[model samples]
Target: MYKKETRGMDIHTFATDGNQEGVLAELEKGIFVDSRNEKGYTPLACAAKSPHASVDLLRLLIDAGANIHAKVGESQRQPLALAACSGSLEKVQVLLDAGADINAESPSGYTALLHIMFRLHDNEMLLPMAEFLVQHGAVMDCESQYRESPLSAAYLRRRWDVVRFLLDAGADPSPLRWSKLLEAVALGSCHDVKELLRVPGALQQRDRFSRTPWLLAAFVGHLDKARLIHAAGIDVNEIGQCGETALMTSASIGNPEMIKWLIGVKVDLELADEFGQTALTQAVQFGHADCVEILLAAGADPSITNEYGDKPITLTTSEEVVRVLVEAGEDIGDVSTEMRRILIGLEGSSTLRVSKSEYQEGCQRRFGSSNPETMDVPFWQEMIRTGIPAYESKSQFGDLYEMTCVWCFNRFGASFTALPDGRYVQIGGEHEDYYDPDFCIYNDVVVFQGDGNFTIYGYPQEVFPPTDFHSATLVGSDIYIIGGLGYHGSRRFGTTPVYRLNCHTWHMEPVTSTGACPGWIYKHKATLSEAGNITIRGGTIAIAQDGVEDHVENNEVFQLDLTCMTWTRFAAEP
Candidate 1:
């Protein structure tokens, strides 16, 4: 064992000392040239990394059975990687010539060429060593564990020449190429855009959100890039997946400067999105007072109702917005009195107080009991039959009380359904992974009512869609949910189901069953503006991947316009 250790150290010392003669002579003395020291370093690795060692020493070590492929560190520390990171061009060549794996990776997944490009910042030999690694089959665009490419790293390091070299070798920078024009505009990096556009097929680039280069540029107020894109002849008013023109997008986010720029260029101001909301209405909905003022100055009509018959003024309660609309010849009389009262609470009014939740009630509620459709489990059905008390000890809201389980009403979108027989019912709501012992994690379609305080009827039906922040609006004794965010049948989305509950009879059923609602959303403002219009305004579109919440950017304003009690989705707000 002592002989083996001594042989390893002797060869390592000779290799690192640039003693080519000693390295050869040690082999003649039967010292194992490739033996590793305590640091796991072979003699060839030490020689390759030694700044004082000549190429001849490295060659002698390789010729004397030194391991070219032997790695030293827990990570990559192979002979070629060591030579490459040191920018030792001659040693790198020698190791490659002796059949080292050019693409050999460290334990952390860095390739040899990657080590060279990553470490030698501010060194004049960076480009040359980089070129050498690529010539010897080192992947120029090799990715690390974080999926960072060589081009991305070089760009981040401001190594312009290295970035250009990597591009020249066909290193496709998917991250940059994906958003070259947009990012250039956003960062005001006009000087680098030319090289970015030089990337093969750059002109045809679109972002992951499918926004064209010019749209992003204009949205960020970059007129120079906008002009460049406009010169390319793409439509400035072209609509995106969100159904927004650059003008509307700028208007939506309240970029008055961008809006003015777009207006100066004579883009269409009257172009409404698929939702029938003009740029003026979008600005109003988002409370962009500046955008609204600007659009109104640009001759945007305030009285122009969206598809929902709601004027721009109806989307906002802002005094500034109201002033703008009134100045633009809009009448305040167009808003319903109920809406006005709701906006400003009914303080000391003569209107008789309805049920605490606003559902109409009466003495004799409708028909016989519904034999609930078979869906819920028998155990839950038995529990429902027993009922939970509305007032475990005492009632909080009114004299009337109902014996009902909290399970039916403890959901996200669930609300009090007013019954004609002086009672109320709860249909559905939403919940996630909650650990409460008393309440079930999810709500069922079991019936409950405030009829003495409201009795909890056990699970009567298995609801198809779930309720997560679904909106509820009451018109007389009929309670309606506009749309909800959850699974429909099996697929989850921002689904619009015309769910109607007769507080009179306590019977709930699908009314329209055909209105193709927008994507799922929750916490949006939905209101029955008048007789038949249910306006659903700005909300987060509910999107989930593997049951984890996904980002929602849809500020969609849609409405369900009812005709003879049936509903149709309208691209309007009223």
Candidate 2:
């Protein structure tokens, strides 16, 4: 029980602690039953989440006018969802009996059924509670805002029993929006895969990214499922939307077994994809020595070059792969110095370091266009590392000393916004101080997908200049980039710079604004309100006065009403 001397203890604490007597005392004292705590959980939400909560205690709170219909916290979870998530059937029954909406959705569109299967624990009541909810009219195929259904959630949790139950309960194995067969294959569920394959036309379906079940099976090293898919009549050498064959996919992922099987089945070894890379080149570039040897033994060519003029030996840094290729009559003199350095870095845990000239030249040449043919670089969209060193002054015995500090791009003040489709966008960032020779502010956008693939996008100077220390707020389908410490002579007084990048088309356009401006600001924060206003606060603005830069701390808060593209200043009240 909470002591009376412990003053300021409210009904929320009592509800959280499951103190029935303390809650009654607070109720008698006339405390608001629906008042929220710091984390936005009300008294009922607090009680619903408490493991020690009783049905009678919850009934008392509801009797005291606690709202069963209320959704609380950042997730906006209902009391029924909270009760269901806590694995308490009695609490769930209490909330449902008190008129809680069983199918009510959270902000993310998670129903009570979805919330129970979200984060799986070893609680024995979870499956029973799921069954109870399903019997009580919970939608079994209900999807969240991210299009993740309960069946997919069950597959993600690897609850085969729950999966079997959902499948037996007649959950749709083939949803039009996404493929359940491919998901089952990716998750390595043979039973679910077989069940999903029974759906008509499931074998011939392609996902939104144009990936087939055969390609996914190869990518995930699921040879068993690959054989099942092959038996289901997806030809072993069929090309995907990007002209990607299963042999190239196997080689790229370093699956020697899959490569051997594809070789045994007579897949075309020299067939180039849209990138003009054969199975041998993919194996060598990814440093798969075993796969390389297998491909070479199976009469794969090493002397052939991709569209970027990079041969199998030229793209690889592995001495083993190089030795295998050299023994197969490829000249050792063909390997470039850059590839040799990468080999040296791969010998240990040390990072692969490229000189500033090489790094800049690579970015300029490769990031010139989004088109793979136009880029003409070997490591386009591949794993890359470029470290830039910055010298920092340190105090030693009241004297300043310089030390080198290495920082990577996007490790600084870069903006990362997650897209709706399980991918994210990384915008421009700088390497070091503006005065340093290594200092470079990037004017690029890189979108990374869930499947470990990324695309680098470049823009002209006027469209989107080099940016860093800016806020990229996702408002609807557009990401608004506002305020940054750009290059010298870039920012001007009396104007707030704002640019909107469409998430779909990747097009960037500058936004013209009206009203009072927080001029030339960086290192600030911007947040979107529910009413379509972007509130920016707490940044430094620089003023150039007679060749000296004066930095002023911006204390005033500003709001941009996105509806009108107008700014308003709010002064601090004393």
Candidate 3:
């Protein structure tokens, strides 16, 4: 060992063990470190192998002027790249600070960040190494032999913070030829993803799959985030790679809230996807009753058949949905043979224009076209009068006031003949304006009576108006009012109290637990399955902490079995 040491450090042990300090010292002392080890690794190879060798050691040998870019025996890894791959951020920093090439190419043509990003799992060290390399003029767009850039690697690993840092340090996220912003949003769902979407030039870019952020969010059921993206004006209905619209994607995922919100914004529910299935078909096929209802209400065509020749009604399991479709089919009266002949005649005629002489005569006779754009006040009043009946039929005020009280009475599934005051009498399901009970009659009406003074059979019942949206659900024979806003005098009440209604007797039960029964949630949707399980979906909990108000979609589906008197989470199969 001593004799070989005198001949400088031999390759035999240095190649196997990578103990380069002794060999490095001997090289600084004018002794040549041999490359003929058992595996033919030189001192440089050994130094690169450990990668934790101090900068002083590297510098001492480099001053003796060892090649800074020397490749290892077989792997051909340079010392700087090896240091990066080993995740020795300190050693990497030292070597780069000592004028080691930041842009040096390895045998595989990987930059330092490329090696670090691909090999090291530590983001803390990798981030600094990445920053240091980019700060010292490292090429951010350098594509690996695998056609991956540093930005792509960061995106694949879902390191949005690292991606942000890289982008800030002049990394071109464009050569990725994909929306790293969408990938970040899809994977991380980070709030900082908003920054990437707002990155000025990012919205116009599409991914390799040709999907925008809005399409990706919709596909992934990130409804709230998708809404934010849509409000940013990136074309909510833009068809993606397979001509799949956001509406189709939302429907496929059974996201009723997203469907309703999209419909509320007037998204074309009739638009078909690549598979030629409309949003309504997708919703029905997936058995999303709520989504089906919303789509139907939004005027989705029930008659349009898919490639399978099945309409939306064929996919429903509920009798109520079948009845709705049957009623709708009836409303579309048949076309007459004479009407068809008249339509065909109009279509085939081309010289049907009224002459200018006829128009002048008609205008003079009608006392119109004087200013061309203006009409007589009485004439305009007639037009307004014509619209009043239609407006009243559809308006909320008309529905509440002028519409026959029978319609309102039927809304609560109540049976009554007539009152002495010439008003329709209701059997039950009535509440005052200030305090209303959450009650539904049969399959017809779900009524929420608000708090106010109400005379029930000429007797006043003390009222409590439901404070929040999720205060009630009528499941089977029971009206389950979970949590709501309570008012005591002028003070506001916020509590989660589970109430049950057996026929007409109202019983209150206090839910004394945490997590399962959270306090005072509004805007919740509750469903009662045929198995008698009550499933509550999303809602907003009314509470603030640390000066911050919090709202949640309440992804947990809870089931309260009346027989067990226990609340168990409903774990549905995805």
Candidate achieving the largest TM-score: 2
Better candidate by TM-score, 1 or 2: 2
lDDT by residue for model 2 (1-574), tens:
1112333347778888899999898878867777777677778999998987788999998888889988788788888899898888899899888888899998798998888887443456767888889888898888898988787676545465676677778787654235788778765488888888889988777754466888777766788888888878778778875788889988987899999988887788999988889999989988999999999999998888899877788788786887788678664435653443343241221233444344333433223343211232322222233221232211111212323222234235567665667566777777767666446677777675734445667777767877887888889999999988887777675567899988888888899999987887887878777798888887888777786667788898889989889989888611
Model 1 lDDT tens row, 1-574: 2123544477777777888887788788887777776667777888888887899888777767777777685564689989987888998888888999999887777888777667886688889988988887888767888776677666555566887788779987675545655567545466766556555655556664456777666555566677666665667778765677888877776788878888988888888987889889888877788898899898987877888878887777565665566567554334332323232232222222234332212111122234233233332322233332222211323434432223322234454332345343444554323333232223234443322222333223343344555666666777776555554344356455566655545455666544545566665666666566776676677566797767475555665666645334555543
lDDT string, candidate 3, 159-263, tens digits: 656777877787876754656677665665657567777788766667755767877677667776776687778766789776878898788778888887888
Model 1 worst lDDT run, 10 consecutive residues: 359-368
Displacement of the residue 50 alpha carbon in candidate 1, Å: 1.7
Q: Mark the 10 consecutive residues where model 3 has the least summed lDDT.
A: 330-339
**Cα lDDT listed for each candidate:** 0.62, 0.73, 0.53
Of the candidates shown, which would achieve the greatest lDDT relative to the real structure?
A: 2
Query: Residue 106 error for model 1, in Å?
Result: 2.1
Structural similarity to truth (TM-score) of each candidate: 0.34, 0.39, 0.33
